[model samples]
Target chain A: MISDTAVESDTAVETQRGLVEIYSTTKSFHGNTVLKDVSVCVKPGSVTALIGPSGSGKSTLLRCINGLEPIDSGVLKVNGEHVGVVERSDGFYSLNRKKRALQRVSVGLVFQHFNLFDNFTALENVAIAPMQVLKRSKSEAYETARSYLDRVGMLERADHYPSQLSGGQQQRVAIARCLAMKPDVLLFDEPTSALDPELVGEVLDVIRKVSASGKTMVLSTHEIGFARQIADQVVFLDEGRVCEAGPVEQVLDNPREARTQKFLERVFG
Target chain B: MAQHPADLMESINKPRITRKTKTEKTAWIVLAVVAVLIVHTLISNPNFEWATVGRYFFGFPVLKGLLLTIILTIVSMALGTLIGLVLAVLKIMNITPITILVDLYLTFFRGTPILVQLIFWFNIAALFPDLFLGIPFTDIGWGINVNAIMTPLVAAVIGLSLNEGAYTAENIRGGFLSVGKGQLEAADSLGFSEWTKITRIIIPQSLPTIIPATGNRLIGMFKETTLVSVLGVADLLQSVQLIYSRNYETIPLLIVACLWYLIITLALSYPQKKIEDRYSKHKNSGGKVTATTEGVKLG
Candidate 1:
């Protein structure tokens, strides 16, 4: 476990890895708002956990940071570059599909369903994006893929297809696929939410190993204990609003807001 | 836990009791008798002319017609599939003008009879005697006589291919629609370009659905080529017609054509089954295959 003092000292030195800034971001679907005037800052080399109820917009916020879902109104910036929209002299203009896709190369998202290509083997799933999107040579992409699979302890099953693997094994491969892109920011949306109770530990173990490398990560999860152990900054959201945001100890141990305390009590007790 | 190991072993080793299945035995005997009776009647009937059927089975005119029929089936199916793939993609794009144009093409081809279409193409020279190759509304162009090019063979190919294209387009569009939305989102999140997404993710995922349907179309096209004989093309059926017309051995010549069609259909069916088996292996595991194999049994 990383001590809070060490995380603060590491944040002291600024690096251009993954810097996410969301300002008054609002999103809705069919006139029903999901994220209402939400603002959260995730500094580089820090793991920020968005802990909230099911409909509290944690997943939507993570998706907006990766440009998976477009925001209705507000500014979203990652590493000083606007995401999903471009700012002009007049106002912000939505980026075209092609341009938005190009911007997504630096951001990686791990879905709750694993979403591995059913036609591809584990190694192919990890290697395909590098070969297709980045235009890497076949040998080089395979080599990078093997290294990541090895990191996630999935190298032995590289030739196996998605259906051949269990949920935990598949999520580990999904993580390797995300890491193979070398994205500066990683977003995990309930990585273990779909796994069996016995399988959750394996995926969380891989996530813990990833956090030790000091990569920028934002994950929405229901596991409050795991969030306390891994997240440096914790943001508690309720009713599509951030009720409390601070250091892990401040938010989890000593929540300032009544909603945050109530949520923690319900989750813990 | 209550039973002794010796009693368990003895029970497991005993011969299993089986039912007689009396109805199944009776059905098998009845079917065998009916089959034997049919064979006896066919052999005894003199008008059937089994010898004449054997004689013309490999006759020169029949062989030539078989070759032409095979050629027509292959060419038309290849052209039809290509056109179908393009139209399916355009329909999926859903741009108003392009989609409307594609729909109109599909409707017109599917709604009309292929025989009429073939005859129309055969007599197209009456409508337009010359075909001009140039930009629309431009005076600078060269002309080619339509009658020189619109032979019966050409007309048959065009009619069969265009009509076949409409059916395949709907089949392929169904295949495209069967792919899950999660696959597309995964492709998008990986920063895949539209072309890459379609070629790599969408097409590959939809293939298990497309292949079985396409196999049925191939076999149907083989039989459907018979429609071309009305245009005076020298396909298998036309060759048989020419021979029987000359010798007046209509029954035997028709038998020969039927046997050949059956043989070719059986031959094509083998490979289709093999490909379907290969694809179904993944289909069972992925659980994304919605294209039924019901048509395969018919083919």
Candidate 2:
């Protein structure tokens, strides 16, 4: 166990694997319903791919579970903790504005746009969150960041800005950025769809490596091949509903719903 | 060497790639005409009292005017920039009824003439001489010096700053918004608090926009500072006015102030334009592309 593996620190200790439970989650933006009666549980150490056409509520579902997008009516539980936005039935959310802010730190989301701070180099982007938000020591954060970056094959590009990297490289850094947080669940909102045709695979390789590491991941992706390869469960989304879902092979390849069948026929063709 | 006369002639007649814009051509032509008219007028007018114009520059009254103008410009521009920064933050946060009121304040100040605001603030003491700023529904009061605060220079700074603040707020808000809604989410997902996101993430990303907007404010503030002379701030323009009025050499005395303003504007224009170009460089094709962390690998 001590074969030049260095020391396990606080971040290694803070990783608490937990289950996510959702019941009848619904969300809307400015009176337009984006997700309705959507229910899905992302179990610990499983890859769940939320697949759908554009505006099919895949991203919205991910957004709602993390409390990034406020839901109209829903009960979402992450690590057995309710990720509720407004006043709770037991009055937990009504603590104050400061507490509400504290609640947002638990869920980690990797945006499709890579949203890496362009001004900060890739390493600083990963480094700042741990050092500041988690109050981790600078050396500790940097050490974890280096490991995360090395895992994503971005340890060399740490000093480069987001602007200087290719699309594939940026998303890899984004994965490292999220992994640095060591959250209960890591949500990916169309992580690979925005990438160039050629660059998608390189980023997908990093995600697959992450999958093999047993990190719980909920990805919204257009890369059907990657989903079939990695996702334990594939939820086919259409018209803001879970049209069909099961194992990746069952749902993506041989879907039950007519909408899903039609979607893949078009997508696969 | 091999009878390339036709090709050389074609290259010579090739339409200019970096052709002068309509505005550039117009500016050049207008400048040339104005220069010609000035030279022609000077040549024909032998009896013009040019020496009197030089004489007004040395007078004590004109010196006071010059001092006032410089002071007004410095004070108004400084106050305006600070007010603008505060207003920008307030506008970007959750919009309440009070925010709407602030929006209205911005619109009214930006819409109206600066001269009018200067006059109104200067004369506000006539409407409410007893001013107080303290907790509501309490006898404990804080009296304010109405006359001291209402001095023309003070009023000018207040008016310019308040009015300019609104525009600055819009500029700052624009910069904040340009950082993209997704960028804020990225910051939040990273566990950055609201203030941290704005200062560290949002502000840094929006700098390309903020820089040019602030530069615009710098130039606008410079010009708007002259408006304070309406309240007897003795800014450069007002100083020029007093001198030209006392003496009959109106054109040349006004030209002195004009030359100074021109020089200052020209000096600022190059750097401002350069900064604007630098911020916009990313938009051009040559620079490296930045993708949002949404898993997109933008070229």
The most accurate candidate by lDDT is 1
Once superposed on the true structure, which residue ranges of model 2 sit more than 4 Å away at CA? A1-17, A29-32, A86-97, A137-139, A252-266, B1-35, B46-48, B55-64, B132-142, B283-299
lDDT string for model 1 (A1-269, tens) is: 46885676456424545899899989998998999989999999899999999999988898888898988888888876789888889988989888888778888999999999876778988999999999998989999999999999999999887877999999999999999998889999999999999999999999999989988999999999999999999999888988899999999999999889999999998
Per-model TM-score versus the true fold: 0.88, 0.83
Give lDDT tens digits, candidate 2, residues A224-246: 88888999999988878878878
Q: Give me the overall lDDT of model 1.
A: 0.89
- Once fitted onto the true fold, the runs of candidate 1 whose alpha carbons sit more than 4 angstroms away are A1-17, A88-92, B1-14, B17-33, B136-142, B287-299
lDDT of 1 at A13: 26
Candidate 1 positional error at B113, Å? 2.7
TM-score of chain B of each: 0.90, 0.77
For model 2 chain B, give the 10-residue run with minimal summed lDDT. Answer: B290-299
| Candidate 1 local Cα displacement, residue B219, angstroms | 0.8
